[model samples]
Each structure stands twice: as C-alpha cells, then as structure tokens.
Target: MSATVSREGNASVAGVNGPVLGDADFRFLREFVLQHCGIALSEQKRQLVQGRLLRRLRALNMKDFGSYCDLLRRDPDGEMGDLASAISTNVTSFFRESHHYDLLEKTLIPQWLAHKRRQGDRLRIWSAGCSTGEEPYALAMVLAEALEKHGAPFDAKILATDLSPQALQGAREGVYSLDKMDGISAERRRRWFLRGEGSYEGLACIHPRLRELVTIQPLNLLHDWPMAGLFDAIFCRNVVIYFDKPTKERLFSRYAKQLEPEGYLFLGHSESMHGLSDDFDLVGRTVYRKRAS
Candidate 1:
C-alpha cells in the first residue's frame, strides 16, 4: 500500500552487483507481487524490479534470483512488507495536497465536530497508505485545531497505515529532517514541531499533541484489515497508481464498505474512479464522496 515504484538501481546492497534475475524468477516475482500487493508489473518493469531487489538479494546473502523466489515461496507473509518496500516508492511530505486539508479544515471538520458534539459520536480519519507519517501528522494538526476551536470532548483519532515497516518505524518516531519541513508553514513549524539542538540539530520532532491523535501501524491494503469500525473519511492518495483495474475496483469497493455512508474517499491527483466503481461520486479534484445507497 504505497505510491509509484522507484526506477533507481539498488545501491544499498552489500555487494557491487546482484545476480541477474532469470526469466522464471522474474515471472514468479511478477505473479507474487500482484497476488500479494495488488501491483501489476508489466514486462518492461523487469529490469527495474531486478535493480531494486538487488539490495535485498545481497542483504539476504543470496547469490541468485531463484533463491529469492524460493524464500518468497517458503514464507510469503513474513517477507511481503520488505518486498513491497523494495519495489514501491515512499515519497511523501507534510500537506502534500493542500486543498484536501483546506476542505477538511474549512468545511468537513467543522460540520462533523458540530454533529459529533450533539450525538456524542467519535470522529475517525483513516490515512490509508500513510507513508512515513506526514499525512496523518498533518491531519492531526488540523484535527487538533478544530477540536480546540469547537471545544468538544469528541473521541477523535487518525489511523495512519502503510505496508513498509521502515516507513512505519519512521512514523512512530515522529522525527524529521529540516528539509522535509518545506511543505509545512512557518507558524505550524513552531506550533507543531520542537526543533532539535546540539547533536540532533536540524531535525524536528513532532509535537506530543499530534502524536496523541495518530496511531501509526503497518498494514497492506490488499490484505484483510483488523479495523471493524467504519471511517468518516479515508485518505488513500497516490497509492493506487500501480494497481490494475480489477485491483482498483476491488480496493474501492472494500473502501466503500469500510466507510460510513457519504464518507469521503480522497485519491491522488493522478488517480480516478471513472468507469471503475459506482460506490463513489466525484466531488472535487481527486476527491470522491461515497454515494448513498
């Protein structure tokens, strides 16, 4: 459950180069990835996959692609997260898409908080495929402000999930480099982040208040989810670009089921639900609302 795949060569391997990925191994890998991660790898992407997975092969002290395939065959679930990480890109930033947050801050949250205050209901936002925690933390800032403004004792939380263990660990740590703070405004920088000093200089740790609102967890979007409760909104931006039509359809349908009626489903700028699913209606740029059934 992540964004576009990286085409860069794998340089993190222990060795200078990796063994060539054979045709049989490549085929097995394509099928395995599609089956497990819902990513359809075309024939042209073989070299890219080989290059990216080379680091894994070298790290595991493997000599051949066949052996890697064997490892996957033996323990698919155990290795799926790392495998997905190797192939997918975790490129994300705080407030990557600002307008979505604007809608939430200006309209959606106010309305929801008002209703929740009266109904004594909980507020939930699911940051599906929330890479490295930025999305959910940015979401938390907005949520915290709204809750304070409304002055309600609402049970509100943001569920931040990703398929990469590395990403989830980063999210849980809530620390970031100074350069990564570009998308964040100066005011938010002071308000929501504590600037580091001395040896930890140039890095900023997220405020404790934001951390309280977000629950970072590892999750694969294609697999079964443990969350039984429905969400008020789900932000799944940029993560569906690699999924094929059938996969997208299935994912969207599942998202609809997991959403409250009329809940929002936000997609990436490039993604579209057109001719894919009937459960959602296009409401704004890359934004969809669950159709009332």
Candidate 2:
C-alpha cells in the first residue's frame, strides 16, 4: 500500500540543502523497514530516519525521499542492504555491559564446561546483531581466558551475525580506533590486540588467536536462518528494543528454540522476555535460561 502525503499542516520540514522527508515518505519507509527487517520505526523516529537517509539521497543524487522510496521498491534485493546499513544503528564497544562478561567468566562458563566435559561437546555461541565486532570479540576473549584457565583443549566458536553488510565488513576486518579500547582492560589489550604503526597508527586489531574463534556473517533475523545446531548461549542484547511486541515475542521464541536446554540468552539492560516468552526462565539480570521441559 502506498502512503499519501498531505500538502497541508506542516507535513514536511525542508531539510538542509535538500528535499524534506514528507509525511507519506516517512510512512512508506517505516513500513518498508519493518516489513524487510522487523525493525519498527516509531513516530518519534521520523526525524532520525530523515537525517540518516539524507546522506543516501545525496549519494544517489536524488531530489527527494519519494525517489529514494521508489528506488528501494524497484530494486529491493540490490538496495535493501544499503537501506539496512543506513538505518541500522551500529554503536558498540568492547565489553559493553561488563557484568554480562563477569557472569560468563565466573558462572556460566564453569557450569557449561563441567557438563560438556562429560559429553565431549563443544561450546557454541551466537552473537546475534553483533554490531561491528566488539560483542563477539569480547565473548572470544572471555572464552580464550577460560580455556587458558582450564588448561585443556575445549572446542569453541562464536557466530557473529548482523543484517548490515557494512557493519559485518567492519566486524570481519577486526580493526578499531585506539580510543575505542577504553572499555577493554590493559591486560586484555596487551594480550588480545596488535597495536598499529605507521599509517595505521592509533589503531588496534584483534589478535589472530581471538579472531580465529569468531565467524562473521551477514544475516537478517527475520529471514530463514540456515543454522542447524542449538547454541549454548545467544547474545542478542540491545537489538529487540527496536522491534514491535509481536516481533519481539516471535524472535524470543525463535531464540528459545535455538538455545540448548538450560542454555543462556542475554538481553540488553533495557530489554526483557518476561511477558513475551515463557520458554525461558529469568536466571540473572537480563539473562534467561531455557526452561528444560
């Protein structure tokens, strides 16, 4: 369905040096994004969406939002990735929500390893919506430290996926500005990163050992997921807050199905599965364990 733009009542604000995003354009883009990515753009986000897509309009030499929307509709498969990249927020840092990592190192890993030791099973982690690389890299660091402490070879891998190809490319590159290392400890910085030099000065790259454990891929959570095995832990923090309630419920249910029995699911501090899904029991602050039925 096409959105109708009204000419009256301040329906559009003329953007700086460009065409304003009219009411109809905002409506269309919002629905399009939600339909394609399951990310609901609330009325409050109209300005934010306008600002983010302004650059795309300029890049495409489009005069207005209408043209942009038409382009998206015409070549959705080719342009959807760019639209996703434009609208997706990729703000992230190393070891964000430090308490989650603490829980991983001090509680979850120990318990998981004890059980896996008996079964000779490997650890599998999914960093859903892993923006750039920080979250998965932080997970890899924790696993690496735990493996060193255990003093035994334990097979483990982290699957880091995001919808934005641009973000995934950055994640795969595994490089970051030196300032972004603030959340990371000196010990970790020394052990897990290679400081850049010359033209690459003031940058850090994740050490090969840690990078080896993470596999980065582009994935849309709303689409068919090709993964076959259940994950021991899934880190989907700060992602579902952008989705509507039904989307959140469906996604949480999917996560529950993908998690091993008694496996953990970590959410952002602002998110919860309390009213959305019953398949998981609250085990920690914003942490849930799959109910073993």
Best by TM-score: 1
Q: What would the per-residue lDDT of candidate 1 be over residues 1-293, giving only the tens digit for each residue?
A: 11222123322222245466656677788999999999999999988998998889878988667778889999998889899999998889999889999999999999988887888889999999998899999999999999889874679999999998888999998999999999989999999999888876889999999999999888999988999899999999999998989999999999999998899999998899999999999999999999999
Candidate 2 structure quality by residue, lDDT tens digits, 159-268: 99988878888899898998899999999999999988887788998899988899998888988899999999999998898888889989998998999988899999
Off by over 4 Å in 2: 1-16
CA lDDT scores, all candidates in order: 0.89, 0.87
Residue 155 lDDT, candidate 2, scale 0-100: 86
TM-score of each: 0.93, 0.92
Model 1: C-alpha RMSD to truth? 6.1
Off by over 4 Å in 1: 1-16
Task: Look at candidate 2 and tell me the lDDT of residue 92.
Answer: 86
TM-score of 1: 0.93
